[model samples]
Target chain A: MTPGHLRRDAALQTVLWIAVVVVANHLASAIPIRIDATGDQRFTLSQAAHDAVAHLERTLVVTAYFTADLDAPYHEHEAALRDTLDALAVAGAGRIDVQFVDPSTAERAEAAQRAGITPVTYTVRAWDRQEARSVFMGVHVGYGDRQMAVPALLSIPKMEVELVRAIRILTVDPEDRRKVALLQGHGEPNPADYPAQHPLYQLRARLGERYEVVQTVGDAPFDEDIAAVLTLAPTSPMPAATLWHLDQFLMGGGALGFFVASAQPDYQRGTTFEVRHGIGGFLGSYGLALGREVVLDRVHNEKITLPAPGGRSVQVDSPLALTTTHVERTAHAVRSLRSATFPFAAPVVVADPLPEGIQAEVWIRSGPESTARPGPIPLDPRLLVEPAASEVAGPHVLAAVATGTFPSFFQGQPPPGVRADEPLAKGRLGRLLVVGSGDAAANNVDFVLNSVEWLLEDPSLATIRARATGDGPMTPPPAETAWRWKIAVVAPQLLLGLALAWRVRRRRLA
Target chain B: MRNVRAILRRELIGSFGQPIALVALAVFLGAVALFTLWFDDVFVGGVASMRRPFAWMSVCLAVFAPAVTMRAVADERRTGTLHVLATMPVTSFQIIVAKWLAAVILVAIALGLTLTWPLALAWFGDLDPGPVLAGYLGLFLAGSAMAAVGVAASSSTESQVSAFLLAVVATGLPWLVGYALPLVPRPWLGVVNYLTFEYHFANLAVGVLDSRSIVFFASVTALGLRFATHALEQRRLA
Candidate 1:
């Protein structure tokens, strides 16, 4: 009860508290939190990290190359790195060791250069708001012999995906070569457009694990060396000869991932937003011609808006419409976009009549506000042309699945340069899918992953939204129309009266 | 009324004392930078930049609100301060209501600062304020409700670590439950998951701000506030 005792007691308490916090911080930081929200066969980053670490394939080393110096413009990039390293360390438990390397060092620079990794130079401006010069943000993730270089970790999107990929590359078998193709020729998105340093580019590096990836152009040799043909933005119109070759290739049942933006009219205007590409000749050949027009779905609009002709009156544009669906008749689907903009568009019309024995099932559609448009628009300077009232009309298909016996664009035989006879007898016994718009394929994988799952024959991945955008026909009969009363009485009466007056006028003239 | 003021002032004052509030503020700013610099190119797929900051601000709210609210009540209870407050004349309900209100106010301030994002975007290109407003409103409601869940989980626990983890679990449960249950074979999966907070939060995320989503979020906060009050009362009884 003495004063001396009280002072000592307080000091002891402070020391104990400090000790507890230090130990707690280390222990907690070590405990990797595994998130497995994706149920059934889905391995989240944490789980993947755990599995890789537990395997202890080798000394799985991970080096984080973010500069923690405050003076760096990329100082903003630190938190994500901190959180990610923390997460990785936790998942690795004791097996996977991580070192946060300040890649700004000469030794570090030399290490990165020697790793066969290019220094990802990002132009970082100063946070001071006065002098702005470019700085770089880069990170390396991997183990002893191999490592993955991540240029930057800014947006939290797919960091988990990237991390999982890195771990897989470090641990997986050497024989498992991933077959990926940046499909050649017809304006497919270039690999460079993947932002050579983007996480997607890293994804390509990881996929190089299990498949032989060939960036193929044109359909000629359909190389035996090629596993899948990745056609992003096919620049040249695929001649009918090419289509015939593709048809036969598909008949051989090779995995064909056509990320095509065949008729995205917005590209012509020097802007790429507000676009919906229609698979006209291709899908039309199948059974449906996804109207190559833009579709507007009020049900789901991106919570984005843009200015219209009259500055005061703003137009509601849905930029995030890819995944966010709003609940309204305008969107008229499983979800609606809360944001709106000129960028997100509907699928083009699937109007081409289906060839005999082909069945096309639409995997994704725009809201009731869909509109299809024609295009051969230039992709450079990406922009949607200034909209006319006519351009706004839509209800087009952006993506769909067509499966049947396909008629070869090259019906009878091979082309002049043909060498070996690739098999064509198995053409329509299986399914071939034509996506109206390829936007959902690249980048929007978070939302459109379900569509890819369905396309890949994973049938199990047909998960949500695929239950169907809705049941029953998308549109209703005239009788069920809310304005049916006006149509029944006013419209008919006016027409009849006008006809009668015209007759009377004719009789008078006689 | 006096009890609410005392609690609010204590919460507000406490938030300023530690570097926690400043850290959250800094993180918010960091998010703005990311939005301006990177998200434009990445998120919009190089098509058209968002040119507005609200959508990105909303994403920040999603990450930060849980971190802020996790320690709001749980830290108090863990440090034995909840017991001190419980002994005071203040009712548990007043305490819970005051804390929730303060958290929401703090989030709103964060969002207010983020509003400058659209202006920054506007300086460079055209922007429609309607979606920006809707996006802000969405961020506010979604953030408030998510923070309330954090507060609720915090009140129910004693350790800040557990509370932080639980807050994440609590806020994220809606996404997991809503998206996961639908994939289940159970017949009522749709209806059940639809009832989760995300089904409604997502609605507001895109700017619909449906009465149902509003009510649902309000009810969640109210329900958590009430439950927290009960937890405080239990402490008093003990």
Candidate 2:
């Protein structure tokens, strides 16, 4: 039959016409479909959108505040932002309305100001000129008390995750006090003092999604409802009262996470090798010390500086080494990052003398090619030597959790001058998570959120990796026999199997 | 229309009914599983940096696609079936569309078996499903372009072996193009990379489906099929 004769057939024409209509309809649905390798896309925003259309309540207005500098080449950023806003609309499904307002122009700024929204200032340096990028993500979700608010979303990739978190916040009653305590005193990194851009600050705020985060320090009686205590990298010597409060909390069955710097190499003050937290009497009794020197490992090095620009680098010991438990949650091990340079650091160590029942599980560790400078520490790194000379070994633990019962530094009965409100018998039992480095918890420290989540005991708030990670600019398989796996054996085996199949297919056909 | 239907039905049935093709489909499914889920344990922890899970899966699929589609036309010529096919009352467009549809069906079937990966991930975590959907869209779009390249390569050679090799080389051009791009002239190289299947797919993989990526894939596939048609015309002249 001719092509025209085939088209004249009703059934064939129907199928063809239907195919066009179906493909066009699906294409025109304007439903941006994303099917990932792992079937995570089963939960379509289209469903949520439909739901919103059915049970629509308050209208969600999203105002995007951005730089108005049209001449600048940051339009790439603006384009991405526009795409993200479009995604929010889809997710909102007729409930979320979005508007973009560029603040570079005087009129736009004046309008935004009148709306009680400030254009957050951020300076991003171009090759020549340094222009500003506005930090206004979603300044307002609602207007009145019933209004849902999204403080800001900095990047597009993380917006969906942020949107999910916002949904939980908006949905969940804000007054619910899911307890969280910020541990103070021991030379820990204070999130409140951290810069606004710091992860810890952002993390703490994110935790407020399901938690009532309260700062606890000094002689205040640690509350019972406190689910976890965040012992951020503590720098100053911890006071006895402070140690007592921590021990008591743990004894009361509360959880604690410490993002401590190990005997890190960096020197904040003086020429001391030790990272001193006043908890020596308290934590020392349990057999963990924030070691006075950095822990170095050889296993997980990406690259270290080769003394060149971009430097001939290898990933030996990174100060920002991520000691994640990827394998299995409980018994997960860490990499030996030997060349991940800390510049200088003081790491925590388990003391030689230890009481039984106390366990120290290393969260993250340093690589094999590490050394230690014990006392009268030098600021310059040239002084570091081989292990035989400097006294250190492979796989030094960077972060760890120490837990067991304890004799409070007070061995004898209660002190004579006891206040009426104070309880008798200073002795107590509880678990203590002591980290070595104080800087690890700081904003300037490792922004790897898993560490904080591990520390905070809030797995939901675990830090998502930076957006630039997928580029994998430096990572490569180890050429060394030690790091090289049985791929040599496997590759050949695969080749042999394919060859066998091909030979069999040829023989059968022949 | 009758010719296209005949070709499409024959191609789809012929491709799907073969035990070797079924086994290949299963193997591809196995690969999607390994790449999406088990690849982490394959490389020693921290060695691969396992940067983005979806990116690797797509790259691996890009390498694997031609192996499935390389025989659509090449083997027919090798077996002298093209002479019989050419004498039949069908145009090259019908043959092309039929073979292309067959390849798409084969890939779609393979993709169906791999849905278990996402199902398992959803059962495990509270991940946003859009990116995963976007990822599948990117994969299908990428795989379609690869299928077209396979057709082009297969038509150019009488030997299936040579066709397979050519298809591999052609399919791999996008990777080298994407990798070596930024090192060359910035804006020009950027455009070249943007035209590559991966450039848009990666954007889509993250759940932001820009129209440019869809258009790029469609155009590239058309170009590849057009090249195959030209190669067939050249063969006719010979």
TM-score of each: 0.45, 0.59
Task: Compose the digit string of candidate 2's lDDT tens values, residues A1-510.
Answer: 654454345345445644654454346335544333322232233233233333336666667665543222232355555665576566556777777776667787675665556655555543344556564434444422454445455554455445544544554456754677877656555666767787677767666655778887746557756667777666677666666566556555555666555343333442345556655446556676655555433233222222323535333343223232221123211221211233334455777656665666655444444444456554323333233356666455555666565544444232334233554333334445554445444432333334434444444322222222221112222335422233332343345446646765675688
Model 2 alpha-carbon miss at residue A501, Å? 10
The true-structure Cα RMSD of candidate 1 reads 18.6
Model 1, span A1-510: residue lDDT tens: 565665455456545644554454345335534222221212223444455456665666666665544232233246555666666667666666777666577787677556444554443332223343333355566676676666555544345545555566666655554344555566555544577566446545434543455676555647654555555445456655566666576655554555454434342243334332223555455465544444434334443333345554343434223332211222122121222222334354444465776666554444444433444322321133343355555344555556656665456466566544655546635455444445544444333333333434533212222212211112211222423432332343345435645655565578
DockQ computed for model 2 against the true two-chain complex using alpha carbons: 0.13
lDDT at A205, model 1:
45
Question: Could you say which candidate leads in TM-score?
Answer: 2
The CA-based lDDT of model 1 is what? 0.52
